[model samples]
Target: MASITASYPWTTAPLIAGAPMRLISGPSLVHAISAAGGIGFLAAGTDVSTLSENLSAFKSLLSTSPIPGAPSDVLPIGVGFILWGADLKLAVKALSELPEPPAAVWLFAPSSSEELGSWANGIRSATKNKSKIWVQASCVADAIEAIKVANPDVFVIQGADAGGHGRYASAGLISLVPELIDAVREYYGNLNGGGDTSSFPSPPKFVAAGGIADERGVNAILALGADGAALGTRFLAAEEAVIRKGYQDAVLKAEDGGNNTIRTDVYDKLRGTIGWPEGYGGRGVINLSYVDAIKGVSFEENEKLYKVAEGAGDKGWEEGNARMTTYAGTAVGLVKKVAKAGDIVRELRGQRI
Candidate 1:
């Protein structure tokens, strides 16, 4: 099996990725990262209503600012989809019509491998194998399951500290990433029939996601046997990200994530954005909403207050009294300021492991 870097030949070694953050990572951010020798994924999360338009925007940018190793037949970028709510038919049709399909497709939060398999099959057929499959696994079990079902080209081992929706009670990457790597090697190593190596699908490359903010974090994941590092929270500070200025300010102001951030469904409940799978919750900076919830505030009262905060606009995220959700990973403290997405990618890339 080739390293994850081998599959993404366009990328510089020590592959850095801007995670496909829903409503945040947009065409410009994705293009910037890809243009800077890293891969970025545009968020399609739960809704591809604007998928075609977004793809067109990305293509437009590519024409004006083309990057190295960009194949004429495929766009050197990726699109992320949250499978639990995404319309599979719409996704397939959107990609099928693209003049140059995205180079990769990231699938996350599927209800089951069966559901993931269906999407994978549809996507491969739509892109005609031009796009590679990237499956996000929250634990070792999900890795084994994806290998059996989707046979993903890349395994994104998402740790507990990741921002946004993720499995609850998951381990940090320090333990999770290496464990998954060992499990994958064992699964494939046992199937190597006298080194013939063709009896089963090639082993997938590992990309560690969660609590990674800088080159040191990237180096740590690389040293753990992962082929790549994918960043979500750090990119929230990127100038090209489609994020509210107030929200971005909150991200810059937060610190001591292990103490300030938490994983819970309170944000989802108050925001009225429920429908995640059972074991999933989001990590975000602690705010009045979380504090009130912890103090046994009734759901009715909390929702009412959240509605008022919603009307407050950007003031909702003021540092002294934050009310809105600031979804981010633990390493958010390391993200000190805003920079261009391309500069952020170039700055975050670490030495090849």
Candidate 2:
């Protein structure tokens, strides 16, 4: 498989990417990562109404200082969508009409491969294939289906340790990354055309996500055969990240992830954001809300309390007692302090580059 730089010729080596966190990954954060030689995705999760405005803001930032090697025909940043809830019509209009659409589009959480295919096809059509497709796969079946159907330019393998949203039935990166890679290779090696790959579809680059915060994590995934690494929780600690101070502090204070964090639908249910597919769940540092759920607290009561917490503003995110949804991965513990988004990308890329 080709490396990320092989696909996006403008990016730096040992490629790092920022995961699209809704309301958190805004224009400033996206621009910072791209400026630091890593690509960042603006979270257009379910709403495309503001996408054009956001893209315009990014362009405004670039006007003062342009990234070297970035193509004039396409913006260096990416945009992400949660297919199940996204309005497809608006999405197409934004990409098709926005001057110099983003160079990449990261798609996630489609109900089926057909849905994924439709999105991939629509995006390619709208961008005239100038934008590359990046599909996030949480399991082997999803990866294989994405390959056979969408043939995306990049396959983001998200493991169970991921924050925000991920498959409830999933393995960690140690097992999932290599298995998906092998599956892709096997699929290609067994094509009926008899040792002829000249006509075979090219495999997408593999980028591992989940529980990765530093150089050691990057080295581990590269050893497992990933082209690069993408981080969600680590970036949540970035100064550019549009997160509340209390939520950011919670991430910094979290430790011993195995003991302090959990993956469950309780957080979603309490927050009244509940329409995920059957096998998906969110991981976050355990708090009173989850602890009460474990102790037989009714959903009605928990949700009632959550409403009060919502009005608490930043105070709602207090450690050990937070009722606010602090969506984060198990690697929340590894993120010790808040730094500039560009600096976070540079630190993760490290001296090895």
Candidate 3:
């Protein structure tokens, strides 16, 4: 078995500091993860303005969260994007505008290996800084292809149980992670520099994703040969996650029956994100609208109800109807309280399971 260790300069044992205990992977969550010594990523694919503001917000938070006795140069956050819909130009613009570059850039929902290759090349050619490239993979083949083409610093294997827009045929992390590690090690040969394809002097770090909500999940992944775990659904329950309070409550309320989290094709079709692969799907709670729409009630036919449920119009925030079928994962059961990011990371690190 390979001994695991923290790869980057950042501390690893102290996970989750001031983490936003909500479902959204926003700035607070990012900073909390970084503060706790776990790498956090800012998902900035929503819009250009929001993305810019978020980056600025992250910087401000980092500046404020610095340890009193620690070094002044400590930065505790990274950034990521949905590879398929990523606005590379905008990302570049954000990076250039920022006082400093992110520690890493996570890429998910990639359209193809070629696109990842291009992205890696662009990132390599453009920046002289030390920002690592992290990519998410849904398949063994995808993982291998990405590692070879992009040579990402880290590869996150998002399993089927993951929330948000992951692959439809997503395998569980247990099966996929070790396979990916073995494949990587095989492809790269011995990281000790004896094998034929050993480009680097050491093995690249691999992070596990999906269903990783607590310490048992963390320890399991570590035992499975992963360097660490990338938690999403669990962190959504954190207090600082930028999501609706109602949604957070829903996650907490439904914790007992966490199996209610379902993977379906309805949202993708409704949201017009049909560009995804054929077998790919998403996971979320089955809501009234979702159940109602399937019974021969089309979006056009139920536009008003859908709008009402989705909180239509200008004062929609007041209506509070956008709770049904929101993205989540099976790990939602483990999330009982909306703790800070730092606390969650600490719990996971101290977890013996």
Q: Judged by lDDT relative to the true structure, which candidate is superior, 1 or 2?
A: 1
For candidate 3, write residues 50-156 as lDDT tens digits. 67787777777767776322223324455777656666777676676655566667777667778888777665544444566777887888887887788877777
TM for every model, in the order presented, reads 0.96, 0.96, 0.85
Q: Can you write out model 2's per-residue Cα lDDT over 202-255, one digit (the tens) per residue?
A: 757889999899988998999998999999999988989989998998899889
lDDT over C-alpha atoms for residue 119 of model 2: 93
Please write out the lDDT profile of model 1 over residues 234-282, one tens digit for every residue: 9999999999888999999999988889999999998888789899999
Cα shift from native, residue 75, model 3 (Å): 3.7
Worst lDDT run of 10 residues, candidate 1, spans 191-200
Give me the runs in candidate 1 sitting further than 4 Å from their true place.
Answer: 194-201, 350-353
- Give the true-structure RMSD of model 2: 1.8
Q: Which candidate number would show the highest lDDT if scored against the true structure? A: 1
**Pairs that clash in candidate 1:** none
